[model samples]
Target: MRLQTDNDMVGKRWRSRALTDDEFDALSAASPEGGFQQTAAMRRMVEQEGAAQTELVGLVDADDKPIAGAMVAYTQGRFGLEGSIWLGPLCDAHNEHLLTAMTMALHVAAHKRGAISVSCWPDDVYLRRTSDGEPDGEPDDLLVGNYEKLGWHHAGFDRGYGSIVNRWVYVKDLSGFKSADDLLKSYSKNTRRNVKIARNSAVHVRRLDRDELGVFHHICELSSVKQHFQNRDLAYFEGVWDAFGDRAEFMVAEIHLDEYLAGWQDKYAKFAREADRLEAALPESKYPDDVRKKLDTARRNVESAEHRIADAKERIERDGHVVPAAAGLFMWHERELVYFSSGSDERYAKFYAPTAIQHEMMSRCLERGLHRYNFYGISGVFDDPDDPGRGVLEFKQGFNGYVEELPGEFTLPVDRIRYGLKAAAAAVLHH
Candidate 1:
């Protein structure tokens, strides 16, 4: 091993060679108590997307003893991130301090790579939190306490860079956007129910197969240029479909509309314009006024097409998407099925697509012996009723889940003097 960083009493020894797949696997297996940033997922991400020249590991301390396990340099869509630091198959005091030192080492590597910023997920804290059944806490609370005691703003959370699944994207921003409380609050009671309603309505969740992928692509492509559409390529979905398919399910629920059974009634008379075309091709005497009137009526019906489209949308929801009173939900995992995304024909508003989806999903999961009914996401977080998207905020709040607050993000600058101040700030705001 070759030495890379030192902090007086602590000296970081990096691997003399790059990690091979076998080495990565062997060491990770040895560290059984690993997580998000230290597991196979992190390995795949680093190997696939990160710059390997800067991936850091460790060797010794001031006593010159070897440090166990690994560290990684990760990136996301051109953004630099500090990742996985595992403490072998065990935990110890040295693990904590060593991780702190490793993070600094990575910051040096990240900044040198022209990275605008550097960050890590802090997997050890996550393992503790998840294992302890405590999902509610600030982003930087555990670590931020130390960071605050130093001097950097380790408690910065960019709310707009939020996730549909609350707490999924805990972040520490180095530039642009501050933490917005609106993005942090838990979903409201009624909004949770709406998600339940959608799930309870006997909607079946199915991933789009290869054949259906084309249709989804078409719809998505057309939607992308809309005033609100974001840039996403067909290849992106294909990759996600491949990865998440093995671990996460792609689910879309469908409800059958029964309105068609009582459909197709019109006040206007039926007419056709074929005769008019033929008449125009023939002698003028061949056409009659009655035929002309019939053609004109048909033309008027075609011109009024938008109204029919709207009517159909309303009928589908009113007659379809509805669940019987006793129906329940399914498809939740880990005792929770989040209604992360849903959409339907607007005309079926009465059929309550949004409401049915959530309710059905929750009910199904509950039947399977699950616990929480998550409505997933909400925006806008002010006591003032005048905040933009207050309606959406109020809607989600209807579900009656706990309103949780968390500490935000913080950064440990690269230089030792700067990092010391960052640690000071962490101690102040947190512990």
Candidate 2:
């Protein structure tokens, strides 16, 4: 449908309509505001699963080049048809005219689909913040005001994880990094130590194929249960793999009991030999006290290695030759590599598999020349030590990144009567 601002009667002609898959791909990829949720692949994935009816809608200029776009999903909610946009409408938020026209087009599109209302949480950041969740800059009230002027209802800035999508994320900038070693050097000391420890413990990571989705799903299930959070099943992961194809990577961090045992066994023998030689030399050395101290340290190292070897043997007997310690899902984009989902088996927490997986993914991002590694989603509750998100924040902090606070969601009531009725009915039902 043709869309134009009432005030710009003589401006360039523009129309909003359904875009073809290829059109959406090229347009969204070029749009600075575009994200994975606004892609044609995401629409196909949702449609294949019968989850929602999706439209790849866009506003195009006279030459038919897209000026703005969104992947809108319509699902029947208790209140009627509910439409949502995940990280879009892909357009320059600074241009009031473009945003206004896009919002109007979305309203018409959702209305045509019989939606009561449409909600959007754009990818634009609203404020700059430190990694610790401390605000570092002023909020963007101008952008919020622009949406309000377009008759969209601005949702209040609610903290924590209540939005349809995460409003806060942690991202590491790899612009100056030349290699994985450079990225590693930028990490917090503890993160570097954890990566080293994981490596020393024989934790290794490898990419999984579509057929191995269940292995990653199992890891997710275990992690969700421990965290008391709900998790998606195997089918969902398979769907993601099928939809994203090579763009999605599922990696598992595992430990081989035999390898672990062998490494420790060799270390133990070396430590034992060192201790024996040191003790034998203690009687003849000019620095007798130093020799004795060296002998004691070598013996302690031997004792530790023995304990580790015994533990590896026990694990081999109970868990076979290899054990999957953790798994992570990553989505690749030219702008960044997103750490979408991840979980670790608490039983193998000591192996620090999650940290290893993160280091591996970040290294991959650097290899691809991507500057941003997005550790998506953290609750905006840094001051509250009792908050469940505190642990998540701390884990991400070890990698050294800044926090991005996104503008909250906004809604446009396509059918006011239906929207109000649905709200009243819901209130009465709850009452």
Best by lDDT: 2
User: How far in Å is the alpha carbon of 372 misplaced in model 2?
Assistant: 1.3
Tens-digit lDDT track for model 1 on 324-356? 211111222332344433333443344445444
Among residues 3 or more apart in sequence or in different chains, the pairs in candidate 2 whose N, CA or C atoms overlap within 3 Å are: none
Kindly provide the TM-score of model 2 when superposed on the true structure, using C-alpha atoms.
0.96
- Per-candidate TM-score against the hidden true structure: 0.49, 0.96
Cα RMSD for candidate 2? 2.1
lDDT of 2: 0.86
* Cα distance off (Å), candidate 2, residue 96: 0.8
What are the runs in model 1 whose C-alpha is more than 4 Å off?
A: 1-99, 108-117, 121-142, 148-202, 214-231, 259-345, 359-377, 384-392, 415-431
Off by over 4 Å in 2: 1-11, 426-431
